[model samples]
Target: MLKRKIEIRLRPDGEIEAEVKGFKGKKCTDYIAFLEELLEAETIDSNYRAEYYEQEVLLKDENKVLESIEVIPESILKASNKK
Candidate 1:
């Protein structure tokens, strides 16, 4: 499983900085958009780490696989049907 993490720090000078970890390529940008918008922050600079180039990394073990799945609660589905 791939883990995603966001690190936020407030500097003594009242400047806020955030670092997105465990996300590769442009995907990392998605995690920070909401915070940036809420703070009305203008990006002064962006540095892409080495991991960004490897958007997805597969393990060496042939049996290992990653898949995307979505689950919706039955109650929510029933309620939506009644609308």
Candidate 2:
């Protein structure tokens, strides 16, 4: 399992700043959209961190597909080449 955290800062000028962590690719934008609705806040500016360009990784249970050839890279290659 991966750890996810959101760091929020409230400035004296009534400004809200948030730093989202652990989410990769476009997932962060989804969170931002949620925040906009939840806080009724409009973003004045935006910036992308290094994590923005990374691929989103999904965790799956191995037992669910233990007998599936899709789990094996070599098997997938051989199956595709056969066609």
Please report the candidate that would top TM-score against the real structure: 2
- RMSD of every prediction: 11.8, 10.2
lDDT by candidate, in order shown: 0.66, 0.71
Regions of model 1 farther than 4 Å from truth = 57-83
**TM-score per candidate:** 0.56, 0.64
- Please provide, for model 1 over 1-83, each residue's C-alpha lDDT reduced to its tens digit, 9 standing for 90 to 100: 45878787778996788877877656777766766887777666667665555545446787453542333446867999999
- Clash pairs, model 1 backbone: none
Quote the lDDT for 83 in model 1.
100
lDDT of 2 by residue, 1-83 (tens): 24788888989999999888877667788988887887789888889776666554444754331221112346656999999
How does candidate 1 fare on TM-score? Answer: 0.56
Global lDDT of model 1:
0.66
